[model samples]
Target chain A: MEKIYTRPSYIREGATSGFCPGCMHSTVHKLVGEVLDELGIVNKTVTVWGVGCCILGAGYTTHDSFGSPHGRACAVASAYKRTNPDEIVYTYQGDGDLASIGIAETIYAANRGENFTVIFINNSTYGMTGGQMAPTTLVGQKATTAPFGRDPKQHGYPVHVCELLATLKAPYYLERVTCLDAPNVLKAKKAIKKAFQNQIDGKGFSLVEIMSNCPTNWGMAPLETLEFMKENTLKEFPLGVYRDKDAE
Target chain B: MEKRFMKGAEAIAEAAVRAGCRFFAGYPITPQNEIPEYFARRMPEVGGVFLQGESEVASINMVNGAAFGGTRSMTSSSSCGISLKAEGVSQAATDHLPIVVCSVMRGGPGVGPITGSQQDYWQATKAHGNGGYKLLVFTPESVQEAVDMTYHAWDYAEKYRNPVMILIDGVIGVMMEPIELPDMVSDEFIAQNKAAKKAAYAPGPREDGRKEKHPINVSDGGPMGRNHADWMKYEGWKENETDVEFYQTDDAELIIAAYGISARIAKSAIGILRSEGYKVGLIRPKRVYPFPTKAFADLCPKKIKGILDVEMSMPPQLAEDVDAATKGAIPMEYCLTSYGVIMNRDDIVAKAKEMLNK
Candidate 1:
């Protein structure tokens, strides 16, 4: 009997994941674990988990991990990787953590070319804080804070982090992917692996922004959230490899 | 030990490196700017890292990260900047991460002034951030003391597995003085320090053959258990870690209580008062968080006529601690300056005389 599918070796056996039902955070966590296992760097990898839904990964993943205060994961990862350059370090951050409260740390860490991977989950809402209007929350999109809809006049605009970071000369790699479907999930995995591999190679500041869905926060069924991602989230966030210095 | 002439801020930076701090992240701020400036030039020479963070908030978080990575780490900032670092400092305290933070304080109720002031005594010794956590705060009174405190700071930090603070006023930060510097820890010692921490917690395989345990820092289980343990640790510090100096205090008529630069000024006043046949003395708390309550409790009520609280903080920050230590049994007088006003030795002497006459 050939075992074709199984849990990644990095994820602990019988560990209970704390993410909500139909949450892509678990999917993304699985991808990170798979990447760590494939690279054989699980033992040497240090994970910095940001506050919000991202912290749930600490339960499911078996790694030397620390939970940083909300939104400061990049700043934390910067020093972690710098001090232990021989080891691998990465941060799992949500849109609220990465784009809103932690934007300065995120931008500065990228600008400094800190050799680490940042796994950014853009779920278009503050999943952990009950769906507030995040910086990545789309205009005309409804959130708890924007009960009617996000108004450009009131909330300004949804920030495109990949585009914002592309302007920086220091970043070695930047890609925006999604876990909307099976095929896209595979692509997302590839991007995440490359981000981690870049750190292994001493490449500076690679980010893989995963455009995901929040079924619980978006107030939709699991299947309806996928449709939401395709119609609204994907249109605002647009999936692609935004910047690759190697390719350039 | 070798004698060296150095500025207070630079001495602190060099001392941390000598104590095996291999990673430093800091922002440019007044009075303490020499710290990061020294590290920027020195860290590279020692095979260490000096990162200028975008903000004070980021700098402290970076120190937190480097500490978690099993490296000796430090960060320095002034009063306003320390306010920004409160969040990261609180987080580091909660996790019991060993790191050093130097607050060379300037005046501030809000960016009040850049000159020397003892305004942050409350912030440093009391609530630096949230959760009502306490750091092992060291209030060094001179360049030599600052260097000595910074040198052994990491030992105390690692010993208790908690963040340690070196709180000096801006006067000590910029003042030049002759100091005896400690020998740098050897590279092997540094490596051993790191290896020990890595084995204990740095995100990977445990040295012993067992599953990776969740770092007590962020574990969700046993909130009551964790809080009780922290409460016990703080209580233990009160018993074992209080550091104070009794200068001419025995059988004195009037005793002055102060810390850091204010203590330096107050000591000179004590000297002046003693020469004039006034039985005045000084009580200096080397570690302010423990507040040296026992020092006050031990004073003979029959011999002590009054105690003067001298500080550069206008509203008398350290006085609260002093008052609690004496339980208002001893009548107290104040000679204070605020908003970056330097305390004068003459003013302290005058206040001591006025209190003794009354």
Candidate 2:
């Protein structure tokens, strides 16, 4: 009998990922692994992980990966890619890491057109910090920090990272995708692959913002958060290709 | 072998490039702005990377990234800017990255002045950042010394897999002086340096040609385990890395202890006083992190009456180390200035005479 399916060789065998049940991190990690393997650049790829649930990738993946201080993954990736132009480098950052504390790093790196990929995980809340309201936290959404719901009058509006980066001229690609179901997960993988491919093609900065879910942080069942995502989160952060220089 | 006239900050940049530093990311600030300026022009000629980060924090993090890629990387700033880089410095310490940081210090509790000051002595050698991490701090007293120290800093950094700091004040940073610049490192040396121990941690194909299967995680041994290991590494530096100079200290009844630009002022005082039959000398600490406590221990108590701590800070920072070294056995005096005030040679001479008379 022919083998039907196999895990990407980049992921460690029998290694248990420490992500919470129904967390989208594992799904995104799988997509990255598949993309890296498909490109045959797994050996030359360097993944800089932001401080959050994203850091867990360092444990699950077998490639050369390391953790940067919270919100500085983009800066780190920029240096690595510039110094080692022949190698592939990317940053794995959460919304809190990429959109809040690290917004400047992310923006500047994209502005400089650093040839690197950025996998941004927008989970609305600070998943690693017990569901605190993040920069991407939806207005009127309930978070631990926003117990009564995010009030725009007090707290700021949710940051649309893809739309914000779309205004930058240097970015080569910018797309927002979700991993809500099997079909959506495949689409998310395609977008992530293209982000990496743009770097491989010597294109400028590319970012794929994955609309993720945190069941544990959201205080809901894994399945319940998926429904909530479509009804609420998607309304604030619609999925689409915000920018694609290649298409133009 | 050719001597070149250059500013202290430019000499430092040239020395770093000669020492095989191929990546530089820095933010522009007073006194040290020449460093990034020089790199912007020179790095392109050498086929190296130069970046002016949006902030000091981002610049240092970029250096961290380049260092992790197994390149000789650096970042520089002045006192207040160095404060912003504290976070990246601590992260580099935790990761055991071989990166060089230069501080052409200006005055500061917070942006006090743009002129020269030795206010960052404690920040450089003692509590540079969180976790009580220490850098192998080199305090160069002159422009020539600054170039020399910056050139060799990368070797020490890689040898210990730790950050090395070149701590000079704004006085030296702006002053022009003649110095012999080292020859540029060859391409082979750069390749060998990167492939030496970097292959183990950097991404790419392994020498054995086997694909990596394990993640490059820093917390594998737990925080306590890592911290204890780092503590041992720091302790080893005391014996192997301590560097100092004893200038006519053998038979002196009084010695002036200083570092960097303040040491240059103290030396002038020592010269004049020694010629006039005053039994005064100087103890210059080249590397301050190890504190050169042994240099103090080696001083003969019978001949040394007291030590004068000279610095361009409001209160002396090196005095804490001097006290720790002598354990209150030696009486100490301070001739101090602050807020970018250059230390006066006459004031140090007066302070030393007053201490000797007592």
Counted clashes in each candidate structure: 1, 0
Q: Flag regions of model 2 displaced more than 4 Å.
A: B205-223
- Model 2 clashing residue pairs (backbone): none
Show model 1 residue runs off by greater than 4 Å: B205-210, B216-221
Give the alpha-carbon lDDT of every model: 0.89, 0.89
Model 1 compared with the native: what TM-score? Answer: 0.97
Question: Per-prediction TM-score, please?
Answer: 0.97, 0.97
Docking class of 1: medium
Residue pairs of candidate 1 with colliding backbone atoms: A64-B203
Q: What RMSD, rounded to one decimal, does every model reach?
A: 1.5, 1.6
Q: What TM value does chain B of candidate 1 have?
A: 0.97
- Per-residue lDDT value at A206 in model 2: 95
Lowest lDDT 10-residue stretch of candidate 2 chain B: B207-216
